[model samples]
Target chain A: MKRFFLSDLLAGLLFSLLGFYILFEIAYFPVDEGNIPGPRYWPRLIALGLILFGLWLAGSKIYSRRMTAIKPNLHHPHQRQVLTILVMTIFYILLWSLFGFFIPTVLFLLGTMFVLFPFQPKQKVRGSIRISIYSLLIALFVYGSFYLGLHVPLN
Target chain B: MDAILQAFVSLFQISNLLMLLAGVFLGMLIGALPGLTATMGVAIFTPLTFFAPPEQGLCLLLGIYTAAMFGGAISAILINTPGTPAAIATTLDGYPMAKKGEAGLALGLSALGSAGGGLFSVLVLALIAFPMARFALQFGPAEFFSLAVFGLSMMIAVSGGSIMKGLLLGLLGLFLATIGIDPIHGFNRFTFGIKELVGGVSFIPILVGLFGMSEVLNRILEGSLQDKVLRSKLGRVFPTKAEIKRVTPAFWLSSVIGVIVGVIPAAGGDIASLISWEQAKRFSKKKEEFGKGSMEGLVAAETANNAVIGGEMATMLTLGIPGDAVTAILIGSLMMWGLKPGPLLFQDHIDLVYQIIAILTVATLFSLVISLYRIQTLGKWILKLPDYILNPLVLLLCLVGSYAINNSLFDVWIMFGFGVLGFVFRKLKFPLGPIVLGLILGSMAEANLRRFLILADGNWFQFVFHPIALTLFVLSSLALLSSFKKAPSL
Candidate 1:
């Protein structure tokens, strides 16, 4: 929670810096006097307000740190499952770009099922295989719908 | 009446009806998938519509627009994640219902509410579109600028928990809007001389990164180990007569609010839903049941969001100005077909306008039917598919989606870069929504400010002294100030 507070403070400081940078840019622009309001006027005002607000956020968070944690669910430790999914996603993207759409999608679906929900006593190998086949069918169906049916011209 | 008859004649075409169904079905699927928002769905599909007649193409897009709003509720009910930002409010009540094993009931009420809202809004559009368009024609550049400011102020309404965070994000969005080439002088502001920066950041890529990639990264970091896969029992997918009767008034009210808010260039489905929910909460005798599986809340949000489609379209069709990002793309699609939008458009191409409106109305109905029937069975099956298999495929789609925008490999890389940035932001708990909004709106904001300055001869008073502009300036300031006061400290 303290880390969260500190991070927010840091974000506020970054925004404040950005606000000032904008202000600096506005300063360089020549102001036209004929118009009711100059071009830099409103932007400068907004920037000033943002700077003030950012400073306030950074200042106020220094004293307030009461973290309320929600109870951890049973599936909290599936970090590998998440990582595997992310890696698979990157692979899927690269594969799709190199080898076209359908092939990589099928491979991704099969690979994911094999890794994430590996056969267990309660979850039989047959069930996983059936799920994989069904997933493939769904993927193919989607491919046909989007690519063939809609003519997305997937490269 | 004449326009309605003409619209009917145009919509009666078999091809138009079929395309409407296709658009609705595809939109629902896209909406049901977490991170594939309605805007993204519309953006990806808008190009495909170019081959068809403008009416048929618009019919399909309208179908997608309406159905996608309802489609987001599917994931919100079965999974805790909202498929679209508009469904964020829906998830508050919907996920709880799913947890309590009332997923079927939640879906039923959502569909019913959505249909009611859609039907109501279409009727409004049918009756009021022309008049509204005529009124909107009176708006000058200064008025339009004020309108943008007013629209920007709604960010405060969406800011939940920390007003400071929301303001920070909103400002961040405004800053990002300033990036790329200045609209007035064509001088690059923040592109850093990068050729890719000249066009600024593409909305589609940034959106894909912020919503899709960030979600994947968040899931990875959070570690999906503890997610108990709740198998939602497929029950009767229709609300009871009693439930329908109770929600009828809320549906009507939300539709009215949705259309009114959506007609404004700055306000969108998200704001419309928020306003409707607030209104529903205020009026409902069962207000306590809200955020705890109240059908009224789901109905209000779903209906309002769907209703926004017609409302937003009214402005786009009558005036050339797009009400939201999706509409902006839709405007591009129409322009690609050599169809101009505005009063002159209606006068010169009345049949085309009528055909398009007819297609939209029919498509809205078609979207309702497909969402109610086709998605019920598919929704149950989709819920059971583990995210491990699904998330990767979505990422691929996102990559293709980004690349497909301009057929540039560079955009794909930009998407990946933003994805990494999004991940870092997520890790640091910095909100990403405003950043995307900023990037999308930056150029517009800067251009208008510059134009206003040029017109005013650099007089600072011009922005504040002009009646409409002054009101907007004050309103945006108040909105920013109020949001700061409401922030919940970490």
Candidate 2:
């Protein structure tokens, strides 16, 4: 079975590639003007730093890996749960942008509570309604205090 | 001086006093809650200061900052869960002490140590702030650039592991800083046709996302296995005369270390507490008691973390550079309120400076009294709060906090992006602290470097002639190499 690149060496290699891409982008930047170091000069130096450090990270990591061949634990037991939360967060943001702050926040909070604390199999309805009410109260309290009282203009 | 008297008068106002006490209460409560850090508390509540007088706002925020440091010790002692990052060191001895049925005594020592260390740092701040500000007033761009370099080098010591990885992230941060309009030339550098990027990345979103939302995500994945409190019933919190005599010197020594660490830009309580705990072990005759519930170790952690508040306040109030992320947000909030912090602040807002010192003092005393007499009740309340509820609330706070900064959804999107970045970085075993430090100091470093280059007329090697800059470079190199030696093997 093939595994995703999840080790320090891989992360280092990816970062180094990013450094090279940044340097390549600097070619499009304007050059030195009026004897001053141009717009790209500082970025160039930083890019060099990124490249050097990234190489060091990858090189050192690879050197270490040769000494000890260990598997990168890519999958946690709750990988699906984590994915669900991340997706829920994305949807929550979309809802907030599309349908103003309060509605989305309430729904998001309610949804997150469920995602976080799944309803018990025996008392699913009671747990769901109880959690929903708690979310609503919290939503109102936070919104009223920050939005209404402090006039944060969340909408 | 008249300003001092006037400051004294204003600080004693009933309204200001109430707010100061309220800030302490809120700080303590939030600090005692696992997954709710002092940084998150300040970042979330900073916007509320918009409606209050600057003095009141300062009181509330400063109160929270100081009290939160102490508040974390409560949970550390009771539940073995550090409510805030600063309390991590405390859990070593504090929780063991609680397990031995000395919860009340542990809380008492922690409270007194916190108040004492806080007071000592405040005195250090009072003595050093003006002198430091005056010295800072002489800084040219070259010196400032070297200073930023020195600060960046601190990532080696601060990253907690992998110096190379820390430097890589720091360099990345410096690169990210270059994304907005070039400070000197006024030309857009890397906006990439996005309007929001022109102002540079909004730090509020990054801060809230990395500290707040990512933490929530981590908790969501932890799946609600909660920590149980072993001892809810607390006894009297006062130390005996013999015990006080034994721990007093360590408290003073740790407080000194705390102040020094706190004054350095980007350093914070976690480092100070950890260092002080080690130092306490070295200095103690009872060194064998270190991880086995030593009262001295608990004192060292509590006192040192509290002491950081004073040093942090000095750094923020004088240098316009923050000691940590919380102080960075504090500096931002100050700018939001039309108050600029620097040497000029010390001279022009003399009364406000004095007022801040007063606030620190009062907040410390209030936290001490509350922690001593009320810790039993507070500990129970803290244990009652569930992590699952906190997870969702923190996410909501992160969402609202990011949105509240400029009332922009773009910022919220940025928050979302940084949350993923933070979570991924944590997963990849990279230090998240340096990224924030890099982001905050990035523009400052770039601006100073460019300005210094222009001033030196591109004879860049001439930077070594400047004594301060040269010293800093030397120190930075030393720090970098030292951190490399300290980096653990893979």
Candidate 3:
């Protein structure tokens, strides 16, 4: 089995790549027009800072890892649950944009509640009914406040 | 004295009193909801005030401003989320205190501290507004740049155990601030071909995502649903005599910090609260307990944030300069009423100034009474809600709040993205506070530095010659240097 310190290394790598990308993009920015420094100055300074700090973070982590032989815990018990919620939320947003606010919000709320609710094998029907009513109420309350009262046009 | 008497009498009108009460109630609701800020509340109601008489209108707006600052502490204490950005520092000790079965006491103390700070700032406004406004006007581009540098140095203090990771995120926030058109040349830098990016990132969405949505995500990942019992425990609402005695000095000190920071144009409650929290920690006997639920830290944050309203009012009324976003909207509203705000207007409308002071005092007192009355009931109600139901509701609010900011789905997407980003940062042990600090001070730092450079003909060294700027630079260096000794190792 292969193992590595994913958290620190990944963060360092992510930031370093972002820094390089920003540096690349800002190259096209107009240079100093006169005595005043141009748009590139501030961004350039920050981009350089990102690069330096990213390397420092990664370098420090590597040094620390060499000194300590500790195994990192990478797996979470509820990874599947977290994934389901994230995917469901994405669908909720998509449905929201397509079909407006009411139906999507109710569906999203119901789905999340079902996933999050404590499992009792004997009371599935009751749990479903309770979650359905709660979801409907929340959606309606949200709709009334945002769409009717505040006039947010929740489309 | 006669004008003060007349002003107090004017507040007794049935219509005026109703408007004040309504504003206070509405402001509490707005402030307790995450993403709905005091600025938004004031901006939304500004138009309504145009139809009312001067005294009544001022009363309503001032009531909202006063109560909203206090209201933010409600959500911060109850949940780990801050209702408003001004309450960011409140989450440091407030949430811990809530989790420790002192939710009631936290809310009560927050309300009292907020009222105390509000009253103190109002006194300052009444007695020394002219001098304070004059001092605020002395902050030119160079001075503002220096102040922002000092503000950025606080990122080191807030970085928690990992200063390197904190500074990295802070730099990233600064980079994000440069996405819009350049401040001086009007040249687009990093819009990435999106028209919405021209406005740069909206801070409210970022804030909601980072603090509110991320919290929900973290709870879910921790399998909070499996726990049958809610964690928060309702306890005593009021502080004991000894507790009050311990926190009184913090209240006074932070109130002064809040007023000074508030009087500075472009600085607001958020910055004041942060500085107050740090300074309180430095001076406290319980320094180690600061982030772990120190009463002094909580009192300092709440008091400072609420106190900012008075200093902002003073600056707006005396110098025609807005101290923050809410005050900027207030200035526009006053102009709509044909009430010019500068020295000449004060001489011409001394009676109106007296009336404003009267309105502010009453509003502070009214807010305190309402907050104290509701603290226990609100804390109990929130603690009663289950994690499954409450987490979903919080997520919904986060979505709605982010969307409500610009009526743009892009902002919603930004919120979702940052929520995920914040969750990752949390998992990776990076401190979130410095990122926020960077975002808040970034543009101010960049724009003022450029302006100062232009003023000095690119002579950067000339900045040190200014006494205030020099002093701020020295303070910033000292703060950053101190971080090395204070920050814990990974």
Candidate 4:
């Protein structure tokens, strides 16, 4: 099942499903005006393409999987780290909208960097201070350049 | 001649020159980082150009485009990581040469090859662009539609894994592009009542997200967040007279190949370098050393990739069709500056076109001079920077840059959504380039298609009567058929 998930079969199925949905949705758009292609014509053509190619991908992948006996190795060491960072970023964006830029941005930067950095028990204090300072400086720079210089309203 | 003189005069302005230098320096830095691409470098820095005049902005972007192509070689030699996708071929011989303790020599050869190739392609552009623009000006609606079809057919070449997957993604991009107001009719379609959707999905946000934020995520997932690169010593940087003579044939062959591929829509530096490297290998007497540590191979790859910049610019400037993803963004930038690229550009803004030529030439020379002086030290320093620090910084820029476009958090959200999609797409081995091309060309194709139909009065067969349209359609078919052949290995 894991091997199947890693294959193009899943992608094909998903795309084909999306294609059907698009086909259904574009039905609401008005039909072509005589010869001139209306709004629906282009999308209808694209949706049909999606269906055709999506089926092709899935069919090809399935055939290849049957022909071959080897299973793909899908191990990833940093899955947890990646997921954690993604979730953290969501929170960071939320905080950014509600509380404004500096504090949330500085914390997000410092926290992400710390999470990414290799662990060292003895150097934790030093590393923490350095990361904090770097985060603060980065935040300030982005704030100054984007907010102050370019006049982008961060608040 | 007077326009050329005025171009040079404008180019030498203190602010323009300074921006060009800064863009070159920044491009090099961005290109030296593994996983960050030339497209990403251009996209991330695009917002900065919004503040400047068209000339200065173009200079800045062109500097980045030219320098980044060369900059990828730095990591390829030192860390065995091709900093940009274009440098994938560079790693074939670059890493091996570095291992043999000739890192400096490899770097020097790469810089020389890059500058030589870039200059050759620029010469071709100067000779060909005006004529090409004149020819393209003759195209009617049918011919234009067929040309767009031809451009979209290139999806197969850029499709990394499978042609089917590429076509599907291309369709998806086309669908996404149709969300805004219809080009022919005034009716709104697929907006779902969201005000932001009426203007269509913002190109920059999607671009930055797909190339930037998704890259950060992918790096994290790959556990390459803290790269432990083994440092290589920089030895003698300059090549000997005999060595230069040995590589002369490769330089010529690769540059020609580079320009040809670069002129084709959707075919970029990565494809150009791979093809050039293969061709050089076929011609080289020392073919056995082609992938081991051959100077010819390194020079071929670097030269071909840089040469692509000129050919890409030629197509973009003359036909208003992007040659690759980076040029696609550049087209958007040009549009933002209220300048339409095509035959009329030659008639109306010939001075600007001349300035572009001058910028490309000067940028090549400047990058070479800098590479000769200090690229070795710069490469070493870049290799030492940890991804932990770099990734976060990039994410910050992605967030801010996306928001800066419309001064709305909505664009940022759109970027985040696309970033997630980009990551998922990558995991599925889908090509992102097709999506970009599809998005960029969708409206043009759709609009022209309808116009051609109207002009022909409901007779679709009239398309076959137009010689240029028929030729383009034939070429598109051939390109699609050629996709069945085995692609060059990365």
Top candidate by DockQ: 4
Give candidate 3's TM-score: 0.71
Q: Evaluated with TM-score, which candidate comes out highest?
A: 4
The TM-scores of all predictions, comma-separated, are 0.77, 0.94, 0.71, 0.95
Interface RMSD of 2: 3.3
Quote the TM-score that chain A achieves in each candidate: 0.62, 0.81, 0.87, 0.87
Chain B TM-score of candidate number 4:
0.97
Between candidates 1 and 3, the one scoring higher on TM-score is 1
- Candidate 3 lDDT by residue in tens digits, B223-315: 642222224556787899999999998998999999998876556899899999999999888899999988999999999998887887886
> What lDDT does candidate 3 reach at residue B249?
86
- How many steric clashes does model 3 contain? 0
Task: Give the 10-residue window scoring lowest on summed lDDT in candidate 4 chain B.
Answer: B481-490
lDDT of 3: 0.78
Q: Write the per-residue lDDT of candidate 1 for residues A1-155, one digit (tens) a residue.
A: 33345666777787788789889888766564555444455567668867987887787666565423333253654555655666776777788779977887788777765655545687686867776785688578767755776666666
By lDDT, who's the top model here?
A: 4
Per-residue accuracy of model 1 over B251-346 as CA lDDT, tens digit each: 888999999987776467878888898899899999998989888887888788878877777777775656776676676567657777765676
Question: Which candidate, 3 or 4, would have the higher TM-score against the true structure?
Answer: 4
Scored by lDDT, model 2 comes in at 0.82
| Candidate 4 docking quality: incorrect, acceptable, medium or high | medium
lDDT of 1: 0.69
**What tens digits encode model 3's per-residue C-alpha lDDT throughout A63-140?**
766433334343654665566777888888889889988899999999988878876999999989999999999999
lDDT of each: 0.69, 0.82, 0.78, 0.85
